[model samples]
Target: MPLQKSPTGTWLPARVPQSTITLAILLVLCSMVQSTTGGYDGSMLNGLNILPPYTDYFNLNAATTGLNTASVFIGGFFGPMAAGVMADKFGRRIAIFWGCIITIVGVILQTAAQNIAMFVVARVFIGFGTAVDGIAAGVYLSETFPSRWRAWGVGLFNDFYYVGALIAAGITLGTGKWQSTWAWRAPSLFQGIFSIMCIMILPFVPESPRWLIHEGYYEEARTVVAQTNADGNPSDPVVLTVYKEILDTLEWEKKEGRTMSPKEIIKTPVARKRLLIGMSAGPFSCVVGNIIASYYLTYELDTAGVTDSTDQLKANVVLNVWCLGCALAGTHLVANWGRKGTALLSQTLLVICLFIIGGLSKKYADNPNAASNSLIYGNVAVMFLFQGFYSIAWTPLLYLYPPEVMNYSIRANGLAFSQFMLNALAVLLVFVEPIGIVNIGWKMYMVNASWDIIIIVLIAVYWVETKGRTLEEIDAIFEGQKHSTVPDVEAVRKGEATVNLAELEKEVAATALIVEK
Candidate 1:
């Protein structure tokens, strides 16, 4: 169904039932823990790097520091290899529970590290577990929420990453003055808290209805749909409409003999296109010049003349706060500007910010005197501005768009592939960022801005709008069908909508035939 304007003249419905809102809140709170863990790790490391005790104890130069930081992504790189299969075979909840367990083990090892080797090894496990937990939680959020709430629910999941960052920043800042090794160890140990929170919350949350249906739990799936969408009124029109769409779409896919293999992701032209766009979320997020700010804030701040440790830590805290606000605003903007429009606007602004940052850094970074302080401050302001824009679109879209474009059959594996791409690029680029900043200075931003322009062109040419559509309805756009299996809920309730199932089946058959040819 097309979107309806609310009484407030916005695209949002006039009012959602309190029950649905409560459920959305609960699910978002639960799923957000995974991202919070990741955010904490990044921020905690950034904070640690700034501490004399941390650097002195580890004797970390640029190369070793890069390795220590990249260790998590290295573990993340291998995580998706098994995470996809586990999520599909075991269940999203089980995968999350086990992933958290692994993360806790890693945290224990990391907190008590005897040497750099042990620290690196512990981080690998943490990265691995985070990857597993993140993929399952991401899929769960996308598949479990009611259609109207899906974007906000999933978008908010990653937005809370900044919440973790903020918490870590505050904690590390509090611990920065400690003379003992506990200064760093205390933060490392705290990293396990988010995963533990996730484990506790999982028991109360419902499984993904799509996963339930795929596993032959039809009644359970229908009941979940009703509970989430219609407050447990099984016969509610919206519930019936959404339930029918899922059933019919899954049936059509089953009849077409869909498999869960990663190879299935590229079996046809449409599928290939979906893979490209879905996986693009990974590189788009990593290469957008945000990595420098995210992982190397201390280095960036020092270069920009904010060399005081307390001042740099304060900037980290403030930056996360700014990003959290912008990311939340971006989620709301998805309704008005849509996925494509929000992304374009964000990248456009990011490019402009990067150029300004590069110019200012060139002018003042090498010589941090009184007269150039304002320009240095401007450079710092642009860095914060760049992060804000990155958070606005990329943070939410990183998890939201990939799962939206993927169908049930390949959603798990496809997301795993996307994670694989993200971690793979991150391991390389995150490791290289400090070196780039050291060697090329301001030119690093210029290089990133140049590449970002290419991504903007690619998005405009290739990306499809997924706003205001249900998961099943989106399939129609790629399948060359004139109508979606989903009926308009309000119209159906008012006896104004008609569904032609036989015609839909024929269209599905024709599309399948085309793929076969």
Candidate 2:
């Protein structure tokens, strides 16, 4: 069966159904729930520190405040490992359900906390619970979206993370009205609203068709693939073709006896390459210094003499909106530049921006007079630009790349491990930022700037392009087969090449024969 040529004379897959797009939106929203809250929760202390009324209520200084923020990443360090098991064993939907429940509990704890200890503990709970939502949503989107739209869909999913950040910033500005604990407590309670929305929607969405096929639920998987087809016709060639591909890919994995354990992932060649590529993104993203920068934005700006609390919160709103816009632009950019290309370009820009920010900050550290005004303004402009570059490369691809690279056998586990590595580094950076600020001041920017230089080199060498390919097709790229970096949607739609199961099965068998010889 072949794709029918439309009136426009362009070959394309059947129009993906509105239902599928709706599902994708829900999944993206699911991702945003935790991220928005995580953004709001993680940075709440930062906003509070600058607001004297709230700071007086909590009696938080730089050291104790850093500890509270560090506690979230501490739980985040372990959350993904636990969530991975749940996702692989129970299903993506169930993992997300449990994650939301735990997050709501964590939110409740934070909202009602009588002391700093209770609030710190609550951060850990939010970290642990929300980590699963982030990991599961990425894996779910990767496994389900059609090949042509996969990168764009995943980009949308990741882009919403800034939506969460924007929301958090808005909440900060809104809540700044009250001089009481409600200023912070209201936002802490607000995080639950998104979680509750997710919990309500989870029951309605279909499970990942790939997971169903992997689990031998062929009938269910077929139905899902059919239902999500643009035309919503199960008999559509595109639907049958995708269903067959899923079946064949699962059979091939079974024949190979591939291990799914995170512990085993590092030992397999293709799997190890995937893991490294995915895992490196976490540290590289951290080394770029966005997480630390976001958490301490208020402090950094305040130190620069943006002393008014409302004014500091307003600055964050503007910065987050700028990042959100960049993320929107990146979704379209990936089609032309490819994942690795976009990342290289983004990282190179980040390195230069960081140098400007660090150099200018260091140049003006001892002097706050009018003579240093240009340096201060330059530092601020570069800092905003820093998020712009990161949004282009890291923001959209952060969720897309890891899952796209991993084989289905270890997809959940691999992503979980990636998140684990991310939070582990985050734990250190989150803890280190305040201490570094107190002791070394603006020089901390120079340390990250140097780290970004190394990240640029690493990405140039190791990263592979997964754009314009299906999940199963990406396997061959890592297996040392020659895969095109060229975008292939036009070819697939024109029937020049189809990602059919029969073709992929034959390819797998041929590879096995070569290995045996």
Cα RMSD (Å) per model?
6.9, 6.4
lDDT of 1 by residue, 1-517 (tens): 1221112111111222236556667688888987899999999999999999899999999999999999999999999888889888888878888899999999999999989999999999999999998998888899888767788999999999999999999999999999999999999999999998987776556677777777766666666776678666756667767766777777777777788877888877777888888878877888889888888999898777788999999999999999999999999887557998999999999999999888888877556575366776888998999999999999899889988888878888888899999999999998999999999988998999999999999989888998877788788778865134557544564577865556554543454343333
Strongest candidate by lDDT: 1
Q: Per-residue lDDT for 156-200 in model 2, tens only?
A: 876777777788788878888887888888877887887788777
Q: How accurate is candidate 2 locally (lDDT)?
A: 0.72
Note the Cα lDDT for every prediction shown.
0.83, 0.72
Q: Estimate each model's TM-score.
A: 0.91, 0.89
Candidate 2 regions off by >4 Å?
A: 1-18, 481-490, 498-517
C-alpha displacement of 239 in model 1, angstroms? 1.0
Output the TM-score of candidate 1.
0.91
